[model samples]
Structure formats: structure tokens, C-alpha cells
Target: MSSTPALFRLAAACAAAALLAGCAVVSVASTAVGFAATAASLAVDATVGTAKAVGSVVMPSKAEDKQ
Candidate 1:
């Protein structure tokens, strides 16, 4: 199955143009917002992962055998 929103949008736009003679609100900003949120979440996840890898506070494996 196809899940491409852009393809659907292009089809809708084409239909609208063929049916009407005016403009349409294409909701490009909502798509941009989704992209921005996705990028931000990915960045935050990467930062947390890097901190866990390099700067994470490690607890003692043992009293004297702590890492």
C-alpha cells in the first residue's frame, strides 16, 4: 500500500485545480511542523544516547569494584 501524503496531496491539488478556479490551503505548515518535531526528537534522542555513552554517571558495580 502507498502511504505517501505528498502523493495524495498532489492528487488532491490536481483535482482541485481541475474542479475549481481558486486557491487552496495545502497545509504545508503542518507538514513542516511535523518534520521539525521529528528532527527535534531525533536530536534529543541522539543527545541522550551520546551522554549515556560518554558522560553518563555510572554507579558502583561493587563497593570497591565500581566501574
Candidate 2:
């Protein structure tokens, strides 16, 4: 009967450990996805800014024409 209680405790510990490990894995994956999304957003902003700069150089603004 004592051995049965010890076995139960060991099983419970294992289950708790597995659950904690799963949580950690999920946290890491979500963090990585967040970083990737941020990086993609930055890249898109940079590309748009470059295109605008190029466009401005190719076609001067009406304000520039007035000046």
C-alpha cells in the first residue's frame, strides 16, 4: 500500500513536468513568431520608404515645380 502511494506520486510528478515543458515550448514558439512578424513589418516599411524615395526622384512634386 505504501508503494502504491509512492507510484502515484511519481506519476503525478511526471505529468506535471510534461505540462510545464509543453508550456515552455509554446512560449518559445510564440516568441519566435512575434519576432518574425516584427522583422517582416520592418522590411515592408523599409521597402515602401525606398520606393517612395525613388519615385520622388523620378517625378518631382508639384510643390517643387511651384518653387
Candidate 3:
């Protein structure tokens, strides 16, 4: 679970949302897009954090590495 992959997903989602929103003329649609972007950002952050926490549990410590 690399941060790079998670960030790429977030970027792709935002791009898709922006592209899909171009045909609309309503304020609510724009608001929804904004909300979607926010949600995507949060989701990426949470996923990356979770992956790091799990890796910390499974990965070897510095003392183990030295051996």
C-alpha cells in the first residue's frame, strides 16, 4: 500500500468529478463536486494512515534488521 498509489487514486477521482460536472449549470452540482473532492482527500489520508499502522505492526524493527 504505497502512498503514491493512493494519491494517484485521489487525483483520478477528482479529475473524473470535475470532468463530469462540466455539463451542469447548477450550484448544487458544484457543491457536490466540492464535497466529493473533500471526501476523496479524506479517504486517501485515512487509507494511507491505516496502511502505515498495519505495516508498523508487521514490519521488522531496527534491532531485528541489525541482526
Candidate 4:
């Protein structure tokens, strides 16, 4: 089974938790931590998606073209 979806779900969960923590913690330090975690999670998700798209691109090679 592909792990990408599972990874996305996990990231989403992390982001949700961070948002909830921001609302519940109510301290400056905790709010900052929650925001940081949310940002990091989004960054990771974007990076992984970009990496997958880049990795999936196929370039035509001279050898393959001749076949």
C-alpha cells in the first residue's frame, strides 16, 4: 500500500492538534510553539509533495528515443 496518503493524514492530524493547542493552551509560549508546529507541518507537506512531483517527471533520453 502507498504510504503517501497515510503521511498526509498524519500531517493533517499534527496540524489540527497544533491549532487546538493554540486555542487551549492560552499562553504566549505555548501559542508560539503551536504556531511553529503548524508551520513546520505545512512546510513538510509541501516539500514532500514537490519532491514526489519532481521525482515522477520523466525526461526523454537519447538512448530511449532511438529505441
Local distance difference test, per candidate? Answer: 0.75, 0.99, 0.90, 0.87
Q: Candidate 2 residues 2-67, lDDT tens each?
A: 999999999999999999999999999999999999999999999999999999999999999998
Mind giving the per-residue lDDT tens digits that candidate 3 earns over 1-67? 6999999999999998987787565777888999999999999999999998998889977888999
For candidate 2, the TM-score is 0.83
lDDT of 1 by residue, 5-39 (tens): 88999999999886664332346666788999999
- Model 1, residue 53: displacement in angstroms? 0.3
Mark the regions of model 2 whose C-alpha exceeds 4 Å error after superposition.
none
Estimated TM-score per prediction?
A: 0.47, 0.83, 0.51, 0.47
Clash pairs detected, candidate 4: none
Best-fitting candidate, measured by lDDT? 2
Could you arrange the candidates by TM-score from highest to lowest? 2, 3, 1, 4
In angstroms, give how far residue 42 of model 1 lies from its true place: 0.2
Q: Which run of 10 residues does model 4 get worst, by summed lDDT?
A: 55-64
- With candidate 3 superimposed using the best TM-score fit, by how many Å does residue 30's alpha carbon deviate from the native? 0.9
lDDT of 4: 0.87
| Candidates ranked by lDDT | 2, 3, 4, 1
lDDT of 4 by residue, 1-67 (tens): 6899999999999999999988776787787999999999999999999987875676555677799
* Candidate 3: segments with Cα more than 4 A from true spot: 1-25, 61-64
- Clashing residue pair totals per candidate (backbone < 3 A): 0, 0, 0, 0
